[model samples]
Target: MVGSSVEGLTFDENCQVLSVTAPAGASGLPVMVWFHGGAYVTGSGESTKYDASLLALEGVVVVSVSYRLGIFGYLRDNLGLLDQLVALRWVRDNIAAFGGDPSNVTAFGQSAGADSVYALMLVSDEPLFHRAILQSAPLGARGPERAEMTAALREFVSVDASTSVDDVLAVQKDALSMASARFSPSGGMPFGPVLGEIDLAPAASRIELLVGHTADDASPYVPDQPEAWEIATELVFAGPARQLAADWTTAGGQAATFDFRWRPANAPLGACHCMELPFLFDPAGWSHAGMLAGQEPDPVLAKTVRSLWTGFARNGMAALPSRSLELGE
Candidate 1:
């Protein structure tokens, strides 16, 4: 996968942005900008599990982004909404160079990354992208409250209540380092989109959405607990796991929901949180033991997922070619 770097003009301190290109010359392909999931802390643009070459081969330009993670990104006034907004703005301006349609871009993410996509949809009225795909992420009470985040930031940075904002800014890096170290014990930085504000508001009724969860999503994150799945379902789905369908129905948004309950032959659970990625990216030789083992290319599932994604990017509605709904009708 050939690629190039573009420096973001607006933020001089930001890293040089990298975008992978398709073998087909950059001309008029739809762009898919991906955000990696690491609980908003770890992970990078260069994960082997997220190789976009397959999607690029399918006549779409795929760009995986690197954003400030952990304290650097999420320990902010507004839960790093500004950083994501900057990334979206950058994609809108520069993706055209890599054969992507700037006007036909889609934002896709998993886990915390999925939260970012929903946050972007909620906050941005500008419509930087045509559509969004959120995987295994449900609304949480932890997002979109700037003052709460600011207080957390103060604790994260270890600034005295009397410290000036300029002093806080001066010690930001040291604070970030300390905060990153202390994050896990303190339950990590409270990061996610801010709500009700213009920059991080909820999506309006007209916005199209594709939202779903895996049957065993909670297993990997919290292993060995019999009730982990139940807890996760209740916390994320906003009630019992069974009632998610009803909750989604009451939300009054245009969306297609999938259960993704089909696990592989050797796996115990169907469709864990990050399971759909290999099917999307076709990670052939990568050795990520947790998620990418024995993941052979499923042309049928790949075609279905990518076609739905691209179709949504083009028309704000994802239609599978198989004509069968993977989730219940």
Candidate 2:
């Protein structure tokens, strides 16, 4: 870990900025700011799953952050968005010290992290990022409402939902205080981002973007629940899913979409969520040999995807496709 700090930010004493850089001789590396996903309720920059050292070796400076997750960072008390914005500000001002080109930063995330990427684009009109990659999360999806969230909190705290708003606020304050007393700073459930009021600003158009979902995105989240899987499939692919597709297109955005329905013939399970992660990271040399399903990870596919990502960070166009991943052309 390279020791560093950014200025013009006030973190809740426990929070600190972390920076990771490529080895020496690696010059002019692109920077990727990665955000982890755990339904906005869990997850951190320290997950073993996201090792940026590999990407750093690929000539990219990777900065994985430890933002307040759940209630601590997402309490929505008017300061929530400000807190996230400050983190981006830190990246903007200080990433250059670690050999990162701040101007060419791409924000990447999966699931709730992807949700944050979408929210950041919509809320931050100043546009701190040059490109964004949202995996397994589409924009404009319905999440929890504030009132519903409050009621859930009330139930968790064993308080009556019918209590006055001010009383409910008191309960929340006390609950947060008690939570702090018992657990370390890391223990907190993040309430997801809000839309209209706190994030009332329109989406940023200048940044290049890559947004898509896995063929079985919700698989990992609810594995072994067959009925749940069917419901999610309908929801994500057929039902409101089309609206999300239309929303992406209507935004005048350049995006590449893929449906990875490649399931192993022997495995009882279908294409479930998070199946794309290993493929995207191309772990276990699967990209070279292909998966058991005979679904090869085409270099053309990898190049097509990574080129769009890197090219977007370099220049804000998804770029002309060099090859096709889907059969339709």
lDDT per residue for candidate 2 within 28-63, as digits (tens), equals 567788776765544555544455554565567778
**Candidate 2, residue 274: CA error in Å?**
2.0
Give stretches of model 1 more than 4 Å off: 1-16, 141-153, 159-189, 196-202, 237-253, 268-270, 291-299, 318-329
TM-score, per-candidate, Cα-based: 0.73, 0.68
**How accurate locally, in lDDT, is each candidate?**
0.59, 0.55
Model 2 clash pairs? Answer: 70-189, 70-190, 71-189, 216-272, 216-273, 217-273, 219-273
lDDT, residue 114, model 2? 78
Highest lDDT against the true fold, candidate: 1
lDDT of 1: 0.59
Q: Candidate 1 deviates by what RMSD?
A: 6.8
